[model samples]
Target: MGTVKVLVDDLLYYNKKDWNAKVGKAKKDNVLTVVSKIKVKSAYIYELISGMYITAATKFLKFTSK
Candidate 1:
């Protein structure tokens, strides 16, 4: 989550947008406001990969509730 957030911050800064524009889930949605389609795709990929890793780790450790 932290890694993804950092990537998002970089994306926001790259686009000259507010670094902390919103809070919680709203922040994630702000990525769409980026003008460059390529940058948006890159940010989404970064977030997806980070989330995948987190999901895999949680499953490996059996931390998720059934």
Candidate 2:
């Protein structure tokens, strides 16, 4: 529908932390983790297909359960 934008903070700007801790198992997992910080200018679901799914999953986990 519209453009997708997301603001991420404290993201892995450097290659710090363990591989699992830094990137996790899936790339999507890392992306979701990063998107969690985007309170403003978050990516729009309609604009993104796959990327939004990861963010949506992150939000679901944050709101629904562990």
Candidate 3:
């Protein structure tokens, strides 16, 4: 898959070392928010691939669960 150009653009916009450094996970809604002067929408495929009965953290936990 091709890397999203917007991701690169966003990276340049913030010049962050990593995704989490630039974007943040919302505590209340658990939504990922890009913490920068620019506005962008953030979504992950796992949200749709998995059942709606889960949250991003839950999905992440399942993937990394041992």
- TM-scores, all models, native as reference: 0.16, 0.19, 0.15
List the global CA lDDT of all models.
Answer: 0.23, 0.27, 0.24
Q: Write the per-residue lDDT of candidate 3 for residues 1-66, one digit (tens) a residue.
A: 111112111111112322343332323223232221222235332221111212223323222221
What's model 3's overall lDDT? 0.24
- Most lDDT-accurate candidate: 2
RMSD of each: 12.5, 12.8, 14.5
Point out the higher-scoring one by lDDT: 1 or 2. Answer: 2
lDDT of 1 by residue, 1-66 (tens): 222222222222221222333223323223222111123322322223212111112111222121
| TM-score of candidate 3 relative to the true fold | 0.15
Instruction: Kindly give the stretch of ten consecutive residues in candidate 1 with the minimal lDDT sum.
Output: 52-61
Global fold similarity of model 1 (TM-score): 0.16
Off by over 4 Å in 2: 9-52, 56-66
